[model samples]
Target: MNWLTNWIPKIRSTKSSSIPENLWHKCNKCGEMIFKQQIEDNLLVCTICDHHERMTAKQRLCAFFGSEKCFVVEEPKKYSDDPINFTDKISYKSRLKKYREICDSDDCFLIGIGSVEGKKVVALSMNFKFIGGSMGRALGNAIVYAADLAVENGIPLIIFSSSGGARMQEGMFSLVQMARTTIAIKQVKEAGLPYISVLCDPTTGGVQASFAMLGTITLAEPDALIGFAGKRVIQQTIRVELPDDFQSADFQFNNGFIDKIVHRSKMRSEIIRILDILD
Candidate 1:
């Protein structure tokens, strides 16, 4: 009996296995259970519903430009990390530190230079993981730098915007970025270079009001939320019921706010096609 008990213990120990975290993902749209690898291979889109998931700035850049062909541009070193010394339960500097560790980025915006089909292009991708991709001084500087770099290299500029609007911690500094980024986009347009804007999930607030809408060819991912204000806010303000799909990519395209609805899989080719046509 003792020998039998010892054998059973050994068998139980051998049978036990730990499942790693993040091995599976649940699609928010369709509630489909998908393997993490499968979702990533599909560019984070849901296999069943084709719902596009939010991607990190670096992920988007690598996906669009090919990791081997992309080079990151450093963010400006002079901008203040906490301009207004804001504090709400936690200091702004502390919040920045936390998100920096989480995102491994200096700010919400990331700039990179890459070759798309052998044509040089400067791209700016916003990281919504970092404080909702809030527009701030650093982001404004990065936008200006990207625009200038595209102009200098005689290349096109592309901006992928996914933001909740302006950073409230930065106060007026954040609000002013809308104007600054607008001016930067204007500079790119003046240089006669293409400035393509790709609106991703939840592009709203000051971002949509400014450069996100000022693209030479504005593009949006399927089912992306694009608008100046949220549906609830707009409805409350206007005192009218909004459409069921208000501010969706399809809705915006129908209303002529967006030029096209692009899928993540076909985005690179579509951009290349546009570049070739413009070239």
Candidate 2:
């Protein structure tokens, strides 16, 4: 049998330009096309529509640091690789290997310290683009370590939650992160430092069940999804249709699950206000 590679085109032409495409992402609110780097500079907010797009953990840290002068707390590197050799529709190891080569990150979490609006704050961002932002042991460790560091420094802890929930590859190990992260947030709270969690689009599953819900002042992007379980799953179990905006930021705000619903343009001011109030 001939391999699929045999059918590939033999004639190839090289382009003259080498510059990468200035990629653009559309805003869900006002349907505006935003430059990726510009959006990132504005804390992932669409400049035209003020729509907030969820960013990678590293990107979030960079924005927090660039916007506010602060230092970083270097946490230990996290673990990666398939623990159980898991396979669903695809092989976990195979997928991991491919992404590893592409993204070069084994885990989905990154923790760093920075100032938000001139107030010292710790940040933890969940990289949703990486394996759907699945939380593994290293991610859990980063969360715990960040929380502990915040407590040690007597500063606020801020976490950007954007995840598909626990990593299927880690099995029970991933499930344990829920508790690990929650306990870490509590550790910060016990020290009397504010714990602010930002719920980005699709903050659900293990993330919503843990520290995302326990923030001393929880803030969510306009129209973010925040919930422990999905609406469809809940509806199927309860045999009833859910509200139109179930698990949305509006729903969470109305139900008092979150402190406020802030737009991307107003996020900096809102965070500063929270810091002032806490101070």
Please report the candidate that would top TM-score against the real structure. Answer: 1
lDDT per residue as tens, model 1, 12-118: 76666555667899998898899999999999999989999999998899899877447666565558689989999999999999999999988887788868788
lDDT of 1 at 153: 89
Candidate 2 segments exceeding 4 Å error: 1-20, 23-43, 47-50, 67-73
The C-alpha TM-scores of every prediction are: 0.94, 0.83
Q: Candidate 2, residues 44-80: lDDT per residue as tens digits?
A: 7778866677776676666656633355646665565
The top-ranked prediction according to lDDT is: 1
What's the count of clashing pairs in each model shown?
Answer: 0, 0
TM-score of 2: 0.83
Model 1 scores a C-alpha lDDT of 0.90
- Residue pairs in clash, model 2: none
Overall local distance difference test of candidate 2: 0.79
Which regions in candidate 1 have their CA more than 4 angstroms from the true location? 1-18
- In model 2, state the lDDT of residue 114: 67
